[model samples]
Target chain A: MKSRDLFKKEHSDEQSYVVIHPLDDQPEQKKDLSNFEPMKMTFTVRLSLIILRVYLISMILLLAYHFLNLTGIIKL
Target chain B: MEEKSNKIPDRVDQPSTVIRTRYRWMQKIMLFLVVFGPGLIVMEADNDAGAVSTYTQAGAQYGLHMLWVLLLLLPITYFSQEMVARLGIATGKGHATMIYRRFGKWWGRFSVFDLQLLNFLTLVTEFAGINLATSQMKLSPDITVPLVAVGTIIMVLTASYRRWESITVFLCLLDIAWIIYAIRLGFSFEKITPAAISFFPSGQGITSSYIFLVIAVVGTTIAPWQLFFQQSCVADKRLRFSDLGYARLDTMIGAIFTIIVAGCMMIVGYMAVHSAIGYVYKNPAQMATSLGAYFGTIVKSGLLLLICNASILGITAVSLSSAWAYAEVMNWPTGLELKPKQAIGFYLIYILGVLAAAGLVLIPKAPLQLIIMTVQVLAGIMLPSSMIFLQLLLNDRELLGNEFVNRPWNNWINWTIIIGLFALSIILAVQVVLPQLFSS
Candidate 1:
């Protein structure tokens, strides 16, 4: 039987099936889920730090640039 | 092929007698109502505080020279957004989620970095907008800022998709204020010449300052955060192929509204400020005040109140979008559907973002002007890269399948925007750097 037909029959039988072309008949590999882990770090603290740092740097650079421009230290 | 006669009389042949339809009329009705969330909300969010401010600035500075850009962006915006809609529908995934899954951790982390940074900066701008708006009303920021923040939290958290979308659409309609304001400008209808036609640099002659502002207008319009937010909204709303028509319609309406508002703002600036006087104010409030003084009190009050309303509405929408993008990237429960407990991290992060922004405003020594300008520059720098990534992702056949993919014409326009933005950015940089070098 053709692999496509065989796979269809297996699917109808409530079984997982993998089809490989005759030219490249490698066996299908399944991913192992046992070692999977959730992300570490408290979401609140990390997110807060990220937001704080972004705001601070942006504000500093912006003000410095503006001051320089306004004081005629920088043109345009 | 030979066994067709012995196939136990196929289901089609046996089903001719006594047909009974299993109807799902009510379910279909409910689904139709629910699909309204993403399209309307995303569109309204695009009109947020920064956009209003940018439009106002563009109008004030260039008069109507940049009006063409707005008209041009309409189709571009619709096409780009439609691609995102398709991505969401085909994959049942958010933009960030797809990037993580397909490209693995490196690209995913890079996207996260870009999103978080941009979201934070944009959030600060939103807060500043709210502050600017409220200050015009003579309302204290302490009360106005907190009241607006709390109100947004309550609205986004408490409302279901149907209720939330209806309210957002209602707020979206407030954008009509621009139309009303623009009508007041009274540009010549017969001749219909664009107000400011000169391509030469305004004020400091071909300087970086003018170039940066020009780039800022474009950058702020088609932002990176918008891509993540819109795609996630599309996926979360669970749009399907059948709904593509409605989705496209929604996007077209939004793009048109965005451009119109932009055009009006420029006209108002041209008529009220640029024509009457040559000086440019630091923000929208001053411009509105200038309008009131030159035109009348009615125009002033109308512009002021509209600015405030636009600011509050925009901040709320963009903040929620930022939160949604972050949550989707982290693979956490994200959306207005989730309760505080269900998405504590998501909600908390958003609240922290608001508070930090507010805190910046409260600081005695903070440079608000610089913060706003830098945000604009950063937004400009990030836009081209995001467009490139979006174009690549949309064209990937494995992701989009045969249903939808970029055509050559689409590629032409997308590349045009990319090249245009790059040239604008370079011009802005040179404009800024060259003047300083020569002057020194």
Candidate 2:
């Protein structure tokens, strides 16, 4: 009876190990919620944005000068 | 004893088992073949007739002085274009698509409008150039028009992507005719030192006429359409991030080819036209005729044919590029892959552009020369804005990611082009405004 009980206990322990091992091996599954956050506009990005703006302004001014000259409005 | 048994078993298995390789040699060959299209196409297209005419005129009028300018423009072209390739890979979208997404609808609308107008104007020039060349062979515009139109339509429509690319590259190879003409012009291999060290201004006066040509050379070399076209092409081809190195190599090869062709063209003009004991023709066709008079009828006719080929091919390429950009911006069907019916609206615009330009040429009293000059001036005016947009796009981290942003060296080079172009625009504006200012 004692031997039979020990065998039963060992089998139960092995079964439990089998069940828990898979649970442990399976990584925690969490959806990456960080992507759900709105895109943040940082300082470097804003600075780059400003550079583009400046470039546009300069181009506009230069174009205006060309048109004025072509139309004989500006006597440069 | 147990360790020895385990090692013996492992060694025996290793000796018996085969090692599998992940990458095949054939895969490398296929990748190379696929990557081969854009670089050769772009470079060959640069040797188109209008570009040839520009280079010829530059060399004939300025001699070897402006040859240095071509050398200078090389790096600018490579740097600007490589950025486009990166953008394409990073975004998986054309330049126009990215512009729409990042800048909103207003800017998107503006860019489409500008590109379409320019594309139309350029198409007209291309037809004009074709007609001009065919006319030299005594082929009437009537015959030439239908023939060229049908031929181009069939070629683009019937051919698959790989075939279309190959055919275009083959046509581009005919641009080597320029090199042949250069050789005939008697450019000594030993004369490199003299050509390199030569410093003749060759300008009759310190006038704005001279300055305008300088600017024109720069403007023509780094046209705005090239930037949009190249990046979008790279994106369309689905080049991966790893292929960036190969793409950069492609662009460098293209720039080098452009410079070599431009250099040879200048030498041809200098040796043949500038040194000849006769008046130089004002136009490229006229120059060809004069070259025929001096060299041989065969050489002359050959050059003219090559010029026409360049113009026609260039127009077709640029028109298709514009159409692609427009279609992408509006979220319509795009690419040469789409059937004509499916992409009707897209191709209709392109076909209509060709027809309108051809029709304009058929008119009795069209000022073709003025039309050409207007195209150049318009291109000049629009250049600064194009540069501005390109610079913005290059610096955008969200668009390019951290890995692809312009390095300091890249930024410096691009800005130099911008500054140089701006200064030229200013000078040209001044020159036009006060025609008599520098007449003395």
Candidate 3:
């Protein structure tokens, strides 16, 4: 069978799929997996990323808010 | 049967295996070549017109005391970009789409908004550079600015990914003229060695002006648009996990080449500072002015060429990032594969970005200097949040298989970089606001 057909048959998901030609030199072990689903994160880890995101966004917003106030666009 | 065997050539022997192996190697090489442009282009594009100014300002204003900063950032640049490659290859999604999927709409929209705002402002700085360059050669902004905008529009509308990338890569290669011109103006390795190794700010570097310049340098090297641009480019190019190592190699080579070019830019200004005709610089253009005076018009043309190409390159990348990020967030069809007619929203966003920036640059007395510096500061403010998303996504084992995930030690190093950049951004914001709050 053609390698492209083999690729389609072995892994058909739209995420990611490697088209490993028959004669390529990559190792038999340690395949670079593609088409991966997001691994579920623990609550604590998820909260940390969320917190960092909120804090940084707030900082930028505060800066913007200050500019608006200085320009008398709104009184807060 | 004899005739068929003769035509087959490998019918009697074990040559089929060897032929297939060689053919396979050739195929792999070809694939690598085709996938090579995005990483290198994105990284080199970081050293765009704004970067040329920032690095030149850093060297001219503070000399080699800041050389070590470039050395320090080499790894940070590599680690940061490698995450984008990993995400693009594994999840097969653009950064915006991935953020929307993995996080939520709020964070995703925020990213898109931040990118387009900062990206448009950055494009203005790029056209300003083009205008400055072209005018040095007696070409008016009325002529050059609209010409560049039209050219940029045509480039994105090419609709063929490979053709567009080949054009970008060719421009990226021409950027090396900055270093070559520096050599012609009298760059000596012996003069560079001692200063290159200096590890901290010295002389006039302890002032607020120096501190602000340092942050600008960092911002120039590790801007937020890169994260979005590379991820989208990878998705558009259809890069799979097998291309991961090759992409990282391409990223590394690009980082090294750009840093070397940045270093040469610093040398160009530093030579003038130490020359018998030494004087303080009033603007980034002075680096060219001094070199032009000493070495003649060739130096000016060389500098102008680098500036114009760098600006044009930045326009392509920055505009595409805006288009791709916005389209992905809106769930609209977006890719270079789609004809301009097929992907109207995508092409529209790209065209509007260039046109708006071109219009802003044409405004008389528009304070281009402040606009440029403000965008850098704004990008610095926005970087940590984007990076937070990128890091979490990178470590998510499901998103990238365990084999491709960041290890524990990698997290430690990554966190350190995040904190350092976060701190620099705050300092930069303060300096821009107060100007002399901490200056000596």
Q: Pick the candidate with the highest TM-score.
A: 3
TM-score of 2: 0.79
Q: Model 2 misses residue B94 by how many Å? A: 1.0
Error of 1 at A63 (Å): 16
Candidate 1 per-residue C-alpha lDDT over B110-191 given as tens digits, one digit per residue, 9 for 90 to 100 = 6777667767777667777777767776788778777777766676677354456667777777778878777776665442
**How high is the CA lDDT of each candidate model?**
0.62, 0.65, 0.75
Give model 1's clash tally. Answer: 5
Clashing pairs in 3: A16-A35, A39-B398
lDDT of 3 by residue, B270-317 (tens): 665765275676545556666677778887677877888889999999
> How many backbone clashes are present in model 2?
0
Considering TM-score, where higher is better, how would the candidates rank from best to worst?
Answer: 3, 2, 1
lDDT of 1: 0.62
lDDT at position B175, candidate 1: 72
Question: Which candidate order results from sorting by DockQ in descending order?
Answer: 3, 1, 2
Q: Write the per-residue lDDT of candidate 2 for residues B1-440, one digit (tens) a residue.
A: 00111111222123222122233454344345556556656665766666777787878877777777788888877877777777776666677776676656766777777777776777677778888888877889887866776666666665255556668767866666677788887777666666443544633545555566676677667766776777766755655554567677777877887778777777777676654577664767777777787778897788788778887677667776787788887778766656788788677766766677777877777787766765665565556656666777777755455688788888888888777776675555445434566565
Per model, state how many residue pairs clash: 5, 0, 2
- Model 3 chain B: weakest 10-residue lDDT segment is B1-10
| Interface DockQ of each model | 0.03, 0.03, 0.11
Question: Ten-residue segment with the worst summed lDDT in candidate 2 chain B?
Answer: B1-10
Candidate 2: list runs displaced more than 4 Å. A1-76, B1-30, B195-199, B202-207, B274-276, B429-440
Docking class of 3: incorrect
